[model samples]
Target chain A: MILVTLLIGVLVLVLVIMAMGPLESLGWWSDKGAEKAAATIERLREEHARSDLRTSYSRYVVYLSGIGAIDGESRPPEEEPFVAAIRDGVPSACLVTDVFPYSVSNHGLTAQRPMSWLWRRIEQARFKNPEAMLAMLVNLRNAIQLFVSADRRYGPTYNIGTAQQVLESLLRHGYRLGSGVPVTLVGWSGGAQISLGAAWYLGLTKIPLELISIGGMMSDDYGLDRLQHVYHLRGTKDPFEKLGWVMFAGRWPIAVGSPWSRAVKENRITIYDIGPMQHNVKDHYFDPTAIAPDGRSYLQVTSDAVVALLNGTEVQVIPT
Target chain B: MGDFLGSLWRAILGVWGLDSSMAEWFRDYPHSLEISITIAMLAGVSTLLGNSVVLFLNRIRGWRFALSLVFNGVSMVALFVVQAVVIALIGFLFTGDRLTFFQAARAVMLATAPLLFGFLELAPYLGPGIARVLQVWSLLALWTVVTVVYAVGYWEALLITGIGWAVMQGLSWALARPLSALGNTIWRALSGSPTLLTAQDLLSGHQFMPVEFDFDVSAVEGGERS
Candidate 1:
């Protein structure tokens, strides 16, 4: 009995650890952050043709993926592929932060709001399409591990912790340009939530934060008012997060707070409802993925938007 | 086969109070306040009656037994209120605006199932290892309750447990001191030595019992906050 008990105890502990994922999502399971940073630095070393590589670029545009990973690698997934894409994307002049954190990496920060949003949608879809209902169930079960992610459950847990870790990593690598390193956030799917949470937190520290959310799930302001500007890009067939909007009337100001309508009106939050764009896309379809993904990979557009913001030029939010 | 074992293991753990079922049950359960009061009364009455029965079994007689009986009765009456107040304060501190007094009291009452091990006082040496292990297990159970109800982190749960215990201990010490002095005086009158006032004797004499519910602070699995 004692042996069996111990075995089960150990087994449960292991299962829990696996579910928690990567150092219990404390952001330092392995030295992945440092490893990624080194890889980015190494890539820059070869590409920039700089021998000493003593002083790298000052500014950075960090891409945080939505959900899942790219090429089955630890790196985050990129945007949809394209047709006859424009090559006028981000120039290699500015520094681009290349460490990508996957969505499953944040299984620990899965907040209830997102899951509840999905649940409400599932309930509404019950009367609609049976196929959509099945899809929703599959998505729910697949993402159930992340259902009650606990970032807000604590003062500054999980996603916020990841954001801080990312910065700490950048700072650790002598990447600090000045008192505050100018960084733009390119967040995809759930990654957008992390970016928004992080931007607000980093903003408090006087770090200049610009946000670009691609098919993000969270609809709340996430203190976006304090952010530089939030660019939200939603594709047409992105059926997942739209459920939150439709089910709860998208923005229930009474419960959480009022709609960020004024913020949207003032161009603080810009929504680009990009149709014919699914959640998944080819990588090299366009020059810029943000406004000008004529439509290529978001990597280029994200970089271009950041570069534009860095150069003090307004990147077009719509086709000119 | 492995899958079945895993599921069975989880079910067992659920019964042991590691899962959120208990917490969720309390969260969505109506009549929480009623349940909380009922549990509190149950714990209070059980402790008092259990101790009195122990004293009787030990052959405590006359004035000493009478004194112990009266003290136990009064303690029975006061335990629930004291526990509720202390647990409520700890819950407030741990959960911020998340938990209310009634919820905290309920969590505390549910959490007391582990302390029923105190009934082991009847037979002191019936698996001492089992006693210690149960206490630790109960602490985890308490953690689950706090997390589900309060939506708190494990560390926050630890703080709640620690603070709740410290406050309770402080209260017990305060309440016991006067009774201790009185017991010592009565023992002297009975020509008894201070050291000879055993736990059983004190109860039989209606004196104070400096019983403590404490464990090594370092034993809380992960690192505990100082």
Candidate 2:
């Protein structure tokens, strides 16, 4: 009798833990952040040649929060293939210091506002205090401006100015420098929102911007107009992608409908419901047959994506 | 007598890790009820210990560290007691026989004692809201313990306790930091009434800076003369 009770109790305890445990968005420290850093670094070493200008022909991948990685600290294993595809063909630089640094790598200092404006949304969501959220946003923006003004290399390098400033800056550089450069912007999770902001800004210039979003949370019309191709990937099993939790829990209208579902319905975007896989992309990250076991295979996937984007071909949507 | 023999056969299979299903065991060994019952008790005790250790580690540190040290020292002996009691209860209920209820009750108390201890340990760090939540949780837990004790005697129960300790710890770990952040933000917002920042603030990193209040005045003369 005692034994039976004990077994039942233990099983019940297990069930409770399983149900309530934090949704495995991504591994915070090791598997997500370190793994991603290693992958990016490896691609840089193998693909790009060290140029006199310290400039390499690499695309830029910007990860959005709540997509593949929540913070800069982690990238979903499923995202490894996308990054690897880019690394194989050209040297791609990852902008790790922008918004969403807390959950990214534990290495860099948190970027202030403007560089990390999306943090305001989280602050607003958690506290529902508009004033406080605004304060944080303004403070963050100022910090970014101060940081940006001090660093001249960043100004011309990434065109970090307003639309007119970007035009002037481009004219100064004769529009000849980045003419053939294929800069593919990859935004994961919440970064999908940030990518839209970037797209809106970049639309002012003639710089060819290729925007690819994996698990994007926001659907901005501005981004849609500017984007030539957008690859939105998600998994059906992913709780983060499901709108039900937010709808019931936050009691927000945004939760009532899925963003991807909407994007698909509007025909403004292409959605790829990948896999029988969960939100974590571990299954694809270490696939020896696809990417080399030692993580060499990660670049192959990135290269494939980059080549596909550059060719202006139809986006391939993979099931999450 | 037939019931006892059936339990014994089931217990032996459980101990040997041979027959996971009690129904299957009854089919195979219809005679060794006493032995089967003993096996069940032994297995229940071991499971309690194993689960308790996992729970203990979670409470102290977190899953990341627990994953590293599977055989750490902080073992929860109460887990085994709780497990034994639960198993016995299942057997008694299924067979329509009386169980060692007091023993099971005692076992459950021992298992859950650490959780109470954990609540006390983190009391200082808890804010008002968290404290309120924990207080209610602890009170309910205590009620459960007392009820269990009243229902059963200590010896026969084999007191398997300390279930859900890991779950509690995990919940605490996940909530603490984010909750703190949310609290601080709300507090600041409620207290400070500042203006929104313009694009200039974006450059400086603030929508609005707090107004400075200085009580110092140069030299106040008689009446209006300074």
The CA lDDT at A53 in model 1 is 32
Model 1 chain B lowest lDDT segment of ten: B212-221
Give the Cα error of residue A85 in candidate 1, in Å: 9.8
- Judge candidate 1 at residue B196 and give its lDDT: 26
Best by DockQ: 1
Worst 10 residues of 2 chain B by lDDT: B213-222
Error of 1 at A225 (Å): 4.7
Task: Estimate, for each residue in A1-320, the C-alpha lDDT of model 2 and write its tens digit.
Answer: 89998997785454333222211111221134323333433433332243233334343444333322323443334444554555444434533223442222222222442334465354444245423444444333322322221122121111122222222323333333234444455655445544554454354333466566554444332444555557765545556455422422222445334433344455656555543323433433223344333344433433454456555554343423
lDDT score, residue B218, model 2? 17
DockQ class, candidate 2: incorrect
RMSD of each: 19.4, 21.1
List ranges where model 2 is wrong by over 4 Å.
A1-84, A90-107, A110-182, A244-268, A281-307, A312-320, B1-226
Docking quality (DockQ) for each candidate: 0.03, 0.01
The CAPRI category of model 1 is: incorrect
Q: What is the lDDT of candidate 2?
A: 0.36
